[model samples]
Target chain A: MDRRDFLRLGSAAFTTATFFPQLSFAGTLPHGWLNGFKDNQGRYGVAYIDQKLQAEVLFHTPLRLHGIYKHPTRDLIVAPARRPDTELYVFDVTTKSIKVITADEGRHFYGHGQFNQDGTLYFTTENAYDEERGMVGVYDVTQGFKRIAEWSSGGIGPHQMRLYKNRLIIANGGILTHPDTGRATLNMDDMAPNLTYIDITTGQITQQFSLSEDLQHLSIRHIDVDDNGIVYMGLQDQVKNRRDLPLVWKTNGDTLDMMDEPVEGWEIFNGYIGSVSTNTHGLCVASPRGGCAHIWDQTGTTYIKQKDVCGVSKNADGSFILTSGEGIVRDLDGQNQRHALHFDNHCQAV
Target chain B: MKRFFLFSFLLLSPIAVQAAPSMQEMSLKVTEEFILPAYDDFAKQAHAQSELWGETCDAEKLKPAFQKTSDAWAKVQHINFGPITSLLRRDRLYHWPERRNSISKSINKSLADKDPASLDLDKFASTSVALQGLPALERLLYSDGLLDGDFACKLGHTIALNIEKIATGTDKDWQEALVNIKEGIAHPIYFESMDEVAIRFFTEMLAGFQMITDQKIALPLSSSLKKANGKRAEGWRSNRSTRYIQQNSLALMAMAKPFMSFMPDDVEKQVVAQFTVFARAANALPLSIKDGVKDEEGRAKIKKFLDETRTTRNLLVQTFTKHLGLTVGFNSLDGD
Candidate 1:
């Protein structure tokens, strides 16, 4: 379709009342979403889509946000600044005001957080730059998101996280980096990335599973849990030429299983996975670098090629909604829907 | 020389730093001068090599033709985005540092069976990507000094023909992309902003530099010179690893040239000086990069060249990108 047509469709797709009726969800789904977006003018914002499926800027951020977390019980959404940016904004939909939480000196948010099931406490991935260690900064949500405690994230660059039962699963990316140097990866050769499950109540590590020795350089950075409680993780290989390494893995809290991908389509993933989603149907991984989305089930896998596509979250009907930096939104079947803002990365379905 | 240096210093001083060209101008110029010409030249050379292959079966006669095509490819190899990538021509033309023995093995098996269909360009394009481009031709021409038969020559000819067809198609695709940019119409997803476009261009150039330094030099030379593995270097199958660096650096220099024209005089001169030194070293290297990595002095020279390129890259990031008002995006690799 032409640009004008796309613009019209985009506006119509988000036109408050009319949009929801067109959705297969029928406006009945209780949960909607929160995501990070950069507009055409390079401004960053945390956007919210309520139960009506209407999307708008809830609040603006100074820098790009990599991850957005919603409190399980509260009407609050916490957006941590991307790497090297210490600003974190906590916005309450009910109040329409945001409170800023700054990381302690030398500590920066890794752009991911997860709250306990009851929303009493919150866990954030942080980097202790000076010490070259990763820390999970714990906050008591009952007391104004206060910084109350901290725990080791079990690896160097802890990124995305998912709460499973009472345990928090952190994807410790393993590559060493310092905020002082500004995003330059320090230890690629000796990177030992792993999937660490920590007991949130006691702030103690429960278990960790790592990729095999040859595949250690695949930085396990993003994670999500399926309906069956299977943790699916996404990885980006630190080494560029190792195109054959697996970018998606499944774990049962004991062993990591890599889904078999056809070599031709796998190489197009460009040794990185942009985002991953798991719904009642199956698992989907987005590859903006490779310009494709990989969907897999127990029987087979399919790759849907779309340029700059990254943000992916499950729709109410179990289908996946994919967003791109191009200001376009599409479903897994190549159906182009519209959103007004350019999607930055992860699209979280709350 | 002293007077010229003084003039450059005044122009580059913070007080006199001039405004760079708009991102639109930068994009148009790069597309016209660097990208289009590089792809055009490769298409011509690949077609010519294919014709030469059809005329003779002698290894000596065909080797130079193959080298010309491969050399042409190295110039445009860094243009891995847009049309070339969409067509899968980037990997189809040269799946390097991945196993090339597979290409050799596939070609030999086809030749042994007198695979008549292998001579068809359409058929070959559908075949394994490894057997479709320069790496395949390199194997057919250089592996064990050219296999002994007319079928081998036919296979090489077909591969060259396939590359010519692919390159010509790629040139057309790029021309369309350039048109979209010039017209401010969005045909590709990355046309969100001129700043975004500039960032993409700079990122690719930076990635090219990274490949030359990290993959070509550092990985092979991991730990120390003594522990370096020559086989790990790019283009090792054809002993053109050094040549790969030289050509890749030159292309990167060409892409960065437009930015240089817009920079303050002193910064431009400094960057050019470093680039000149690096290019000279690159050109003066031994033909076979693998052999160069085997010795101490040679290894030192290569390392120094790598360092110079890194310095030039930094100047581009810190000075030119800032002057142009281009902002680099986070998560180029690990997206989510």
Candidate 2:
């Protein structure tokens, strides 16, 4: 659909009395945005929002999902349960059928995964909790999503991964946690977070970059890459009351460089960054803790003020679309809509 | 026609509405009545303790002052936002649940150093947080041979002075935060609205409860009798664990009073009754947290207190946010 058609549909939907207006042209929309949410009645579901901004709940489950991924060449979408959760939900958009994939024994999903260029293989960052190490669980998409192999993630607490060229760029959060202790970080004092690039063909780590000694407690948790191949990372600080620390960094060729703190200071983020996305505008990093999203570009940095804002993704026109826990969908162009759902951390333009 | 007109009039009639407390009013009440006072008390007690230590290293005179300072901290520790969170001051003031013997190792290193510059206040301020807080002070006062030498006494005095500096800075910072909160939308960084202020306060309050239940209580009260480790309790070395819990419960109750006017009458009643039961249980604890976790009879009492606290926390979570028309978001509360 073109921009004009999208605007027309948006206007028609805006006049409806209910919060979510059903669009007749939803099926005709080419692309959709997928996210996890909890409804007003406290039901967990994955929502699919089409090009015309019509949203539909694909399926409901007991697990609270985090990151979502759409198969590169298929109608399948996978939503992984957050860390320490063992379930991964696979939904086929065309057939409206769902498949539940369970993590291997003694391992759990870290809530993020990526598909290979041809879409034949799927890899998910996982925790080998019993062994106190991180692993990348590989699935053979051609063979009914079988768990074919596992590779060392090169560090502890491997979260969010991205496929760049022939390598998988993984954020090793470095914080140690176990299912027995819930989500508490067991090794904050000695955490050494890093960004690891693994060669997909060899299953070996090709390059890894870590922060300086002073920044050992900064857990690199989320990642996004701009069009120019600059990798942006969102960080979470394990130590409290250290608001002077930077929460965003970008890869500079072979090393990691901390981004300049905004004029307003790093305290505004409250020491956590939930999701990171890139668009024509720049790198958009969301901090649900600070209730805002910041766009960092070559010119400077600008922020959008929204309560509990986390999920962010790029629109076709190069603008950014943001979702919040208050059930609000917003864009940089000032279009706003609310639904009876509380959006989770990450959203993907499927 | 007359009956029809009367029915329409009744349908559109204005009903009497009970005005819920405004965000501005709630913020003012909480800040002025609870937060500021607690910070002031903490600063005062810390200053007194520092002065007493400076005058004499006598344990008998210094111990009571240390208790007063700790009690004041327990009252204000729940207010974890704003100025207190600026410079790692909170951890520097009382780093607890110490890991890998960090405190003792730092202390031993400091004690072995012969240079006079080692005991300098400016240099000590830059030391590991483990050696700059109440836990270190507790070790100095309660441990057997730590405070025998002049260097150890000087070290103790330096730590006390460091804590007082943090306490004073925090108190001053909160004064500025109060102005920002009162400014509401006018303030540049503190808060955007009164609702935002209330949400932050409520979230921190819930976090304080979780900390107490998870670390202060559950860590010491292990799963089974054989696994019980009394040393795990906060302030166990000073034998002030039970007293700290009591102070914390009382402080939380005091902080909660401002929100009562916003709740429905039935909810308010239930909350008050639950808090009463929780406070009474905290007060009735018969032994220190160290002994309570290890002894069978004392363990039962501590367990009952823990259960009461959990029940009260649940009641607040279910009612307080709903009545306040506020949501502590899942993403904001527990995002990866």
* Per-model DockQ against the true two-chain complex: 0.06, 0.27
lDDT of 1 by residue, A1-350 (tens): 34465355335433211111122232232486767876554457766555444455555566788888877766778888888778777877655556888998779998888888888988899998878789999988889889999899998899999988998999999966665334655565567899998998788999999998757778898888986679998888665533555788898547988877754545667778878889888888888877778888765777786667788898887778877765566665545744556678888888
lDDT tens digits by residue: candidate 1, B81-116: 666765566667876544425666777678778888
Candidate achieving the largest TM-score: 2
Per-prediction TM-score of chain B? 0.87, 0.89
* Top-lDDT structure, candidate number: 2
CA lDDT of every candidate: 0.73, 0.80
* Model 1 misplaced stretches (Cα beyond 4 Å): A1-221, A235-350, B1-20, B188-197, B280-287, B333-336
Clashing pairs in 2: none
Q: How many Å off is the CA of B314 in candidate 1? A: 1.4
Q: Give lDDT tens digits, candidate 2, residues A1-350.
A: 34465345335433321112232333322586888887655557677766655456555667788888888988788877888889887776665567889999999999999999999999999999878899999999998789999999999999999988888989999977677545656565567889999999989999999988767778999999776767899999775535778999999999888888887788778889999998767788899888889988777988788889999999888778889998778878987777667888888997
In order of appearance, the predictions have TM-scores of 0.59, 0.84
